[model samples]
Target: MQQNSLKLNSDKTQLLLIGSKSTLTKTNNLTLNIDGISVSPSHQARNLGVIFDSTLSLEPHIRQLVKISFFHLRNIAKIRPSLTPPTAEKLIHPFVSSRLDYCNSLLYGISNTSMNKLQLVQNAAARLLTHTKSWHHITPVLKDLHWLPVSHRISYKILTLTYKALHQLVPPYLSELLSPYQPHRSLRSTSARLLFTPTSKLRSFGDRAFSRAAPKLWNSLPILIRDSDSITTFQSRLKTHLFSSAYP
Candidate 1:
């Protein structure tokens, strides 16, 4: 910063130490001295509209999302009675769905409990659009709306990025994280489109990383979807595959 002639904004700056729960617990109260300023670690910090906690569980972000989503849901519900289904859906997508989908690829390996909280928000949004009763089944409503569940939505985002990375549509930093699997010897399955999955010793943390998760998800996809030549085609086929698995 000094070399770049950029002054630090101490008031707006935040320090967050990311690590496993055990490691974070042991390092509580850790502080850093930067240019004669004593900065303490925050349990959570906001970055690019996403909240990250010390342990990277993302519970803080989820909680904030749920709160904001419900606030919009309530506002939308107030006027849903006067709107057509299509109009209601259009309104909800921007306020609720977009927030759910924003940076959701980072949510790929979150706990089911956290995912359920987001699912409930989507369920409420779907119900608001269709005027469904609270006791009614949400799956059928979601399926009718052609909306993938929260989990599948996360996968869709990841797979889309993976496709872009493979095709050089994304930055080199992300593209370099993935490598196409090439067999040393020609075999019957040599035509299969697959990515080399890196070994991850820390399943809880490392497996959720884009480098590991992207390959794992990409490999699990059918060859037709993986072999798509264009991003548009890949997204269309990818959604159908994920929707089937989600609703099946």
Candidate 2:
């Protein structure tokens, strides 16, 4: 770093061991020495806001998100009585929803158990904004707000990036990972183009990769949506489809 006119900041540097639970347990005490500085392994580390754990569980990050979101939810609930619908929506969105949405693509392939942790926070936000009772159903409220649940929200982010990459709108590195799907036989739908889905077994890190998940989700979409005329149109139609299926 010094040779390149850059300096390493030990204060901000952290070393994390990433692997499966079984792998991490065998080397729990592992450490590293960089530039003669001894650095201990961290169970969890945050980089550019995404949190990664030694076991790659992401449980710690979701817990923190739930904690902070409820704090904002409580504050919003107290002040919601005084604010109009639009104003309450404005405040809760940036405070709560934005927190849930930021860098959420990393959450792909997380267990439903983990995904529900974040969904509960979103459910609370919906109820708070609408001044609904604690027991009130959140399905309708989310639909009215045009918000997708946490699981779909994560998929939405991934699909959006994939769409950009498909159109050559994103950087070359991202575009390189995606290829236009070619059928081995004649197809009836002229506009239906799919992404190649990589096959992998479950319960491994490779199964959770964007390369794998992106194509799986893309292929699951309806033919018309897969062949939308533009990104804007795709987004509009995609949200509607997700909203209807989730709420219906």
Candidate 3:
């Protein structure tokens, strides 16, 4: 920072330590001194509009998302009666859907409880748009809206990035994390268009990383989708595959 002539704003700067639960516990109440300025570790920190907790559980981020989404949902509900369904959907997309989808690829492999909370927000949004009662099943409403559930949406985002990375469309930093699978000898699975998945010792946290998750999701995809010739085609086929699984 000094070499770049950038001054550190100690008051605005936040220190966050990320690790598993047990590892975080060891660093409880930890603080740092930088250039005689004392900085304490924050339980959560915001970066690029995404909140990251020490444990990387993302529960705090989910709670914030739920709160903000419902706030917009309530405001939209006030004018829902006057606006047509299409107009309401447009409004919801910018206010709610964008927030849900923004940086959501980072949410892969989160706890089911956290995922469920997000699903409820999407369900409420769908219900608001369609005027569906709470008692009615949400799956059909979501399907009718052509919406993928929260979990599938996360998967969609990850798989899309993976596709881009594999095709050299993304930055080299991300693309380099993945490698084309090469076996010692050609076999029946050689044409599968799979990426090499590295073994992760820390299943709980390490497996959720992009290096592990990307290949796992990519390899699990059908060969047809994996062999897509273009980004547009890959996304279309990928959405269709996930939508079927989500609604079926």
Best-fitting candidate, measured by TM-score?
Answer: 3
Q: Write the per-residue lDDT of candidate 3 for residues 77-163, one digit (tens) a residue.
A: 999999999899999999999999999988988888899999999999999999999999999889988999989999999999999
Global CA lDDT of candidate 3, please? 0.91
* Sort by TM-score, top down from the best: 3, 1, 2
Per candidate, the number of residue pairs that clash is 0, 0, 0
Better of 2 and 3 by lDDT: 3
TM-scores across all candidates? 0.95, 0.91, 0.96
Q: Candidate 2: which stretches are off by over 4 Å?
A: 183-191, 201-204
Native-referenced Cα lDDT, model 1 = 0.91
lDDT of 2 by residue, 192-220 (tens): 67787767665558777878878888888
Q: Write the per-residue lDDT of candidate 1 for residues 132-205, one digit (tens) a residue.
A: 89998889999999999999999999999999998889999999999878889987666787888889887778
